[model samples]
Target: MKKRTDQFYLVREDMLSEAMLKTIKAKMLLENGKFNKINEVVKEVDLSRSAFYKYKDGIFPFHTMVKEKIITLSIHLEDRSGALSKLLSLIAQTGANVLTINQTIPLQGRATITLSIETAAMTADVTVLLGKIEELDAVVKVELIGSGA
Candidate 1:
């Protein structure tokens, strides 16, 4: 048997229980400054305090999950002149701050590059950025390797 400690899922809003949905609304109210206290938010959202507390730290909007975090990407590129420079320039255009970059020595005209970037200031969605990267002529593949604070 396997133990599940850290698992994530993407569920439709309609599939959630009323309490869970209310908890989400309550949290949003607090975050948006509409309510100063948890009590106020719970009241506005019609959720019980205990139920709000139960799901507060467990659920988050999708954008909230990825915003203001660092993401690592693994990219396969053709070892051609200026390919790396163009790639970095494209990433810069998205307003993402590059934290670190690692590249393997070119082997058989191909190289793998790993990049860690801060997404807090990004102007584009991560998915959009990945799509743009994939369309680049010299890029063979791009994979979201990991993300963290």
Candidate 2:
């Protein structure tokens, strides 16, 4: 097996208050689609209903903030009808709002398209979205040209 360079560090378990632990559990429950109603979440996590309400709006998973940034993608695709349309549809499905799109004329059956997109509402990580784009039959190459908040 290959050595794993990415590892997770654990914080002292005792450092967290019972309320905090419950809140974390409640959030996880919500993310996993195991629970939706606040009452259900509070009960599942063993948290007082009031405590759950107090902290729920203030806490969020790390990826929530990361997804708020805007990024520009440069894609080289096979010059074929519906190729661009399919790519745009994939972006919409990923919840990325397109800010700008520039496509160069086809040359030797390939074209370069650049898209600047707001990722705030994206349901998945940028890498995952890029991977999906790469898997499309019409896409020849994809690159992240830049990103910003």
lDDT of 2 by residue, 3-117 (tens): 7454533346467678877887898888889998888889877899888887676555444434647989999999999999999999999998999999899999999999999
Model 1 ranges with Cα > 4 A deviation: 1-6, 9-64
Report, for all candidates in order, the number of backbone clashes.
Answer: 0, 0
Instruction: Predict model 1's lDDT versus the native.
Output: 0.90
Top candidate (TM-score)? 1
lDDT of each: 0.90, 0.85
lDDT of 1 by residue, 1-149 (tens): 96747788878889999999999888888888999999888988888999999998888876676665799999999999999999999999999888999999999999999999998889988878899999999999999888898
TM-scores of the candidates are: 0.62, 0.57
TM-score of 2: 0.57
Instruction: Assess the local accuracy of residue 147 in candidate 1 as a C-alpha lDDT between 0 and 100.
Output: 86
Candidate 2's clash total is: 0
TM-score of 1: 0.62
Query: Model 2 — which ten-residue stretch has the worst lDDT?
Result: 4-13
